[model samples]
Target: MSMSALRRGRKAVVALTTALAVTLVSCSAGEEGAGMGEQQGTPPSTDFFGYQTNSRLVTTNAGTAFGAATNAELLASRLYPAAFVPGPGGQLIPNSDLVTTQEITEPSPDAPRKILYTISDQARFSDGEDVTCEDFLLAYKAGKMRELFGSQKPLANEISNLQCAAGFKQFVVTFNPGQGERWRYLFGPGTVMPSHAIAQKAGLTQEELVGALYAEDPYQLQEVARLWRYGFSVTEFDPDLQLSYGPFVIDRVGPDGEVILKANEDYFGDAPALEQLVVWPRSADTQRLVEDGALQVLDSSTANPTWYDRDSETNPFTLQSQPGDLTDTLVLSGYGLFSQQWARQAFAACVDQGRLAQVSSEKSGTEVAPAYVHVLRHSDPLIPRLDPVTNPHKKTDMELAGQLAGQTIRIGYLGPDERLAAMVQAIKESCEAAGVTVEDVAAEHMSQIHLEIDPETGLPTIDAFLGPVDPMYEYGGPEALIQNVSALRVAEEKLWEDLYDIPVSAQPRTFILDRSVENVVPYTGLSGIGWNMDRWNINEELAGQVTATSEETSEQ
Candidate 1:
């Protein structure tokens, strides 16, 4: 899902290729205008619309839509900012335009581990600022080391230090012993911001910010944290502060939640294919918009969740799909009525994982397996299976769940899709049969609960929520899966307290492309579906047809 160069489309034919196979841009001047051009086709637009249901486009991947389709990496690789790009089979592909080479060293026997990245001098931000280690430091502190600023705990907490060894072009990342096994992927999905712009916004010199990063100054960190957390939001998008180091930069955010990307003429890398790219946040009517020629790419999230469930082998649009790495799974909150471990266990035992997989996949017309682990894929060998006598997805036992029938437990989730809606109802019905009350809660409210401690009660606010549980990466291997015995015990208490994550289910992403697109490849294992979208081109014949229709409609 990385469009960022440092880390990590479709249509027409029904060609079947394997999924392991797997983009352009300018510097400063954007297109004259940014519009979908569905209104009329006379001066037909080369503009394209890419849709995704998840609103989150950040790199932390900590909130709801954790690995949501609109990942910041996906946008960065396709636009301007990028570093060591991910290639086929999870290989690190360095962007010659930015980074020169990257190397990992274990250092001396007693020294800490390190990953050294040397950048090309030609790199420059859209604002004309030189790409520097200061940018990386900002991303690392704001995202991976968030605890320094009293924010939500950061992911990838294993990285001990990140600093510039020489000029801004060269940087070094030191890993904590027994941590950061996946150091190569550190900040891979994230891009560096312009320290100059961020510093100006925070009323500090770029040098001061860089110094603050190195010293971890408590006072300066608070302001840096403020800018890092909210500076790039759609509502708060600032061309100056949220500057682009990638090929494409944000020109404007539309009232309709449309993010229009214009080329950065100052970009040192390859230019973007299409002059104007419009990202359309997915909605129920997204299908109608594409069918009506208002959109060109069904390249993001599927509203139906079953949009790929076509019963036939051939689909109207070109299709590319691979078994994805991120899992869309459910999480039980350790709050309110679920404070008791047995209560969470009882809910797990009653819900049918098979039913969830069945109903959700019935749309793609393709059946899928259910998930059953915390940090490992259900199909991974290291995952402990829970079938036979230990399985929890069975019919509810009223006698066993009679701990309390009078209280209600609210379940939280994101998006407005039928799949989740169906799962929620199913979970409620199953739990009700076991004498427990269940309610639905939107994921937004639950995000606060997951990241923040309530000042009033000093505990998470929500009763329970459904969110994606990232696979092992922050920690070296699957060891984190079963790490702390005491923590595991408290999690599974009820002696059985050593386990808390009730294994539910996981689903991979299925990509549907429009009939008029090309140069799109499907990739498996983490770089998600759109690892290479910057090079995607449109089919003239099919594209022209839509233009003709638009022209005819306007004349009428």
Candidate 2:
């Protein structure tokens, strides 16, 4: 089912359970001033509110909600540093938090390329654990299993006999044969999990610690995998398991789906502007919450359609819309009818892109653009553009579509809702205009579509798949995009080439705060306030603004 529909269904189930007078309470953040002691009017040190999913943490499979959500919260923080960090200008900068300096000491005279990363003395974990060469060895070993083998196993297939060892306060990683050049791309941006703590808990020998990760025994490895999955839980996440070298830490998760976060006092760098952060899940009625003085910051995703109506004098909060990097695209399978570039181009030309955008704007209040490319201002400059207007098959003319009639094409899409339905209907209409017989197949679970390609044909049996692209990690530059595209082209079978995947708009994965919150830095694509719970605080001025606005709206 569509995630939105599933959420709606779950909401109904929760409501039914609630109607039975069942108190559904999970993790509760205790009374504010009780356990932590009294604050002397300088404002409570920890404060923020938000929401969380059912699961706290899970395996980092990239596909699972647990992996995607938790990793976004945990790893992106300064505490768990990656080799490269996203700078202010949305580029991957050097790892300033952990490494003082990095220099490529030796250039390879042979086909293999090599670079050296020198460590600094200043780096330390939150628990005063020195960031050492051993830690890097442990991290690489763990990552090889968890990231490369466990979830993104395809990555490991490209390389042969990857080796690493601790050397004089530095860890040297070398890839075998022709794989050396790809080491930087493979090893960078991975979170270095605490090796000493994890290894000690696992109770394995040093040799076993390094070699057991790549064990051929499936049964033995499954047991070891469980350890990595629940490693944080074993420590009770004490001292805040969501500890960070970053600016924040998870504070509390509430039963009512509210999450609260406070600032990390030990943050290494310049502190953030906002102090407290809160994020409420989709459970609460956002418009009602905004009007009831419960929420301050809102996004285009969560904002109700009614909230954008300028004619509504009863609305208290001002709504601002900005273009984002998210895009909704109609992707075609390279096999079947879509195999021909002209066939795909013909469909694109017939569909009224402007009309589809208008319907989307009406339904969701999100702006839409009429380009095949997903990210805004990021057209493939390498490719020359063709005029859609001048094309013979272009236009919403139904007579033109009749020429391609009787061709059976199945298209898959998410949601049966009005917006998506309108898009589907438009596509069907356009196809019929081109004399094509299109079948609208219901793809309730969009993720499953990724796995549904035929093994023998290597083509997506379904003609098309439509959905939004949430570009979680920013591709730093055109070169990065080129590299990624090239990798996918090399990896993907010939039948999946030239498939459509576009990012249309950008959305800030921000922590929603009550008006009282202050001094929080919003991370893009990371949801939930507790993702960075340590840096949250309550601000009376912001609280008063929410209260006053709610009161005025309620009276109206």
> Could you tally the backbone clashes for each prediction?
48, 52
Residue 234 miss distance in model 2 (angstroms):
15
Q: Which residue runs of candidate 2 sit more than 4 Å off their true CA positions?
A: 1-82, 100-115, 118-163, 166-169, 172-207, 214-220, 224-244, 265-267, 270-276, 302-318, 327-359, 371-556
Give the per-residue lDDT of model 2 (tens digit) for 40-159.
443222122333221223222232212432333333343454555544334455766566433343434453433455655656555555556555554444444542223322223333
User: What lDDT does each candidate get?
Assistant: 0.53, 0.43
**Highest-TM-score candidate:** 1
Give per-residue CA lDDT, model 1, range 1-556, as digits (tens).
1111100012211111111111022222252222232233222222344544233444322211232323444444444334656676555677778776444675554777777777778778777778777777776765555444433323347678887732467887887765554555455543455667778778887778878777777687777666665565665666667566666777766544566677777788788775666565543244334332344455443323333334433233555544355555555555555667777666666666677666656543344666654445455543443233234433446666656576676666664555666677777876787677877766532343352346688765556555444444322332334454333223223322322454455554556665556666665334444566566666667655544443444345
Residue 114, candidate 1: Cα error in Å is 1.9
